[model samples]
Target: MNKKRGQQSVVFSIPPILKATAAIAGPMEGEGLLAGYYDQVMEDDLAGYDNWEKCESYMMEQAVTTAVKKSGHFMMDIDFLLAGDLLNQLIATNFAMRSLGRPYLGLYGACSTMAESLMIGAMLLDGGFGNKVVATVSSHHNTAERQYRYPTELGVQRPLVAQWTVTAAGAVVMENGTDGPKVTAATIGKIIDAGIKDPNTMGPAMAPAAVDTIWQHIQDIGREPAYYDMIYTGDLGKVGKELVIRLFREKGIDISRNYEDCGCMIYREDQDIHSGASGCASSAAVLCAYLYPQLAAGKLKKILFVGTGSLHSQTSYQQKESIPCIAHAIAVEV
Candidate 1:
């Protein structure tokens, strides 16, 4: 028997959007969406991410701590750390774990890092490499903006569907045991190219990968559409989510009833709320605060959480190159 351990459960968490940003940008359509997300997780009253490095660090720390606390475990109990962030040199994630004081194994899959970490941690512990593990993926809208988009000084109007990289972070603790929520299945996403180039537009950048992974998950598992309770995607936002619905129907797989997009689930764009979504924190927050609770409460039975990312280069965009995307799914059966 491969008696290493089976995934007993996984817990995810995140901070709320800032109050001032929500107050200001909330009324002004989608402007407050970024600020509000940052506000929820940050300590200082940051005007923007120009000097927001410390803010990002703080968010990661909170995410890690929150995940640990909620999982009925301690930092030392975690055998290893699986973490990543879309920060320069991955400082946000690295610094966040410093306080954790546990052994670490870093990973990066852009926005898909959370699911990547969780899925892999489940594999490792289930395979006997470790007994208990922690996995996390974080992104800050501020840091993301500085790296991918023009500086704050540019003050350009990004596309509405161009999700604001959520200025947030999320973490999960997975233990090899039994009698709790378990990872029943997973489907890794392949980097798919749909030929999108603009950093300000991520819907097209991430939709193809979302489509590919969702399809793969159904195909590999050989399950019917009604097998799961809810099907969730990370940050395909409104446009991409709609496109995914259409694509699935075209393929004779109809999952509209319980299908949900994390990006679109939390906020609304029609009222100009939450300004699409473009951060690791985007899905993390939804999964942590909203989705996890609902799942644990028995309101939801089976969930397929797909994390999607746009692996585009600013340099490549400047040169008129297309953007590529990737997605991965983590299925938790309660």
Candidate 2:
């Protein structure tokens, strides 16, 4: 049967089930709003590792292992692993996968990797390619700062528009099952550049892409804003969240009631994170720790998870090129 839904979406004939999920976060995130939902919280960002990158890899490994355990499966039973991170060439994920020893596919969707991995994993299961798959992503504040901006030692003064990169990792075990929330459908997004050149203004740079994907998902799925219990945009902090609302309002649609950004949900207002959180783990941690439980508990019947990404590198920034962004949306239902 053809599963293609619309121009950019596909309906899974056999929706893949999310068997279990895990979220591991650093100390600062442990003090955040969703701390109670996380599976594990480290005392510090390093977690006794020698470097922040190694710490990030450790978090991803821990998250994936915990999720697999929660799903009542062994590492050897996992048919495939799909993961990514913010570091160059996905080194964090590579190192983590080296320890996992499973067949793997590395993805690089910037901050949108979590949703991208989930979408692909669901496709694998529905296509009869894998019975069990683990989808995960990780990001570290120290690692992101040194690679994308200035070193943390430099103590660069961040603008109000800048967001804090989250130090966290999240993983979910997906399988063909009758239990748990199902991956119902997904919409693939296209790259959109709003001519925003400042890397620090990532929220603004990615907002247009988030808007585009959300609009397309709604259009292709024939669902209105009120259809889902919540619509979440990944890592589009306060600035981008408001931009999405404004842009939608201009089109005679109102999404403020059920719409929220995963970035805004991570840190407390008084945490002094400026615009809020930004990183691959921003949405990954939230989805695994919070939304999955909500769906499993029947508190939320359905949700649209839209992962937003800013596709800019240090090289592109140095060349003074505009920031290109994308977003992928997955519909999850209990």
Candidate 3:
């Protein structure tokens, strides 16, 4: 059967179920709004590791292992592992995979990695390529700062537009089953460069891309904005979240009522995170920790998860290249 949907989407012939999920957060995140939702909260960012990078790897490892254990399966039972992180060459994920000793594919979707992994994992299962798969993502605030902007020791003054990168990791087990929330459909996004260059303004830089994918998903699936109980965009902080609402409003749609950004959901107003959270873990932590439980408990029936990415590198920024962004959307139902 043809599972292809519109120009950018596909309907899963057999939606893969989300068997189990786990999230691990650093000390800062443990003090955040969704602290209670996480599977494990670390006492510090290093988690007893020698460095922040190793801590990130440890978080990913723990998240993946915990998720698989929660699924009532062992690492040997998993068919494949798809994971990523926001470090140079994905060192964090690579190191984590090394310890996990599972067949793996490393993905890089910037902050959109969690959704990208889920989309591909679902496709693998529905295509009969794999019976069970693990999708995971990780990000560390210190690591991101050192690579992307400045060293944390510099104690650089951040602008209000800037967002805090989350120190966390999240993982989920997807398999052929009817026990949990299922991946129903997905819309792959296109690159959108709105000529934004300032990395500090990532939320605005990625807002247009988020809107584009969301609009495309709605069109491809023939669903209205109200179709889903909630719509979430990954890592688009307060600024980007508002931009999406305004863009949709201009297009004669009202998404403000049911829409939220995972970035904005993580930190509290008093956390002094400036705009909010940003990083792969922003959405990953929220999805795995909070949203999954809500879905499992039937508090939320259907939802649209849009992963937003700012495709800019330190080299690109140094070269004065504009930030190109992308977003991928997944439809999940219980």
Candidate 4:
């Protein structure tokens, strides 16, 4: 039986294994340091599509297909498709699912959808409801910019604190097997509001939520910071990553030794990505393309992946509502 931990976590007795993974990134990411890690790199954000949204859908389609193929399974072998994106109504995910012809579930966690899908998929597999599932997410710089901020056509000036939304997609195939890393625990975070309303400064807005979830996960699992070889957070960027370290110091726990943000890892300093990267793919691409390989190679033994999101819509922002943030944590072990 699964044991409930503390207030918001669970320890699984039958953890699900990650069978295969794939990641596809756009031109900007392709030029980054981890370019060699991705399976496919698009020369342009349009990806030969008429518009950016459709291009995002195409990226997701390719990611899922590649992941399934790498798993040595056909499309029919997948039991469920769990996915989402940054677009309103998840247009990218919906369109991709329509063509995949698989039983699917749509999710919206702003940028945290990747980890959310993985956790839900793990539950289904561990509970014997399914033997195989695919979790995927995508985001496009052009599509997200016009919807959340200014139109890309205008070439609006981005603030120094602003983060670039990544044009990428990533997918992971999970199954009941002993060939890979297993998800051993999960911590579901609660919504946290820190009275921040500036959409341009999302790192500050979402940092508190990430810290909250990280603290809870450690306490609930009764593990110290040294328990994991490393701890990775979704997209907190440089500023937000520092804030997490400071916040943890205030709580008498230090995580600086084994902590890194995918946002900081995705882009290079000369890439002009402002602070760093953000989006659903900020974490997904990094995990699938880089971290998974390290774990599979026995370079890393244990890790905690925390997906963070700022839950705010254009309407909510226009209404002067502060951003509400959330984070979910998954424990992965080789």
Decreasing lDDT order of the candidates: 2, 3, 4, 1
Per-model TM-score, in order, reads 0.84, 0.99, 0.99, 0.99
Please give, for residues 106-195, the per-residue lDDT of candidate 2 as tens digits.
Answer: 999999999999999999999999899999999999999999988798966889999999999999999999899999999999999999
Alpha carbon lDDT of each predicted model: 0.67, 0.96, 0.95, 0.93
**Pairs with backbone N, CA or C atoms under 3 Å apart (clashes), candidate 4:** none
Residue 145 shift from truth in candidate 4, angstroms = 0.4
- lDDT score for residue 156 of model 4: 66
Candidate 4: tens digits of C-alpha lDDT, residues 65-107: 9999999999999999999999999999999999999999999
lDDT of 1: 0.67
Tens-digit lDDT track for model 3 on 16-121? 9999999999988999999788999999899898999999999999999999999999999999999999998999999999999989999999999999999999
Tens digits of per-residue lDDT, candidate 1, 217-260, equal 77666667678898888888888888888888998877789787
lDDT of 3: 0.95
TM-score attained by model 3: 0.99
- After superposing candidate 4 on the true structure, give the runs of residues whose Cα lies further than 4 Å from its correct spot: none
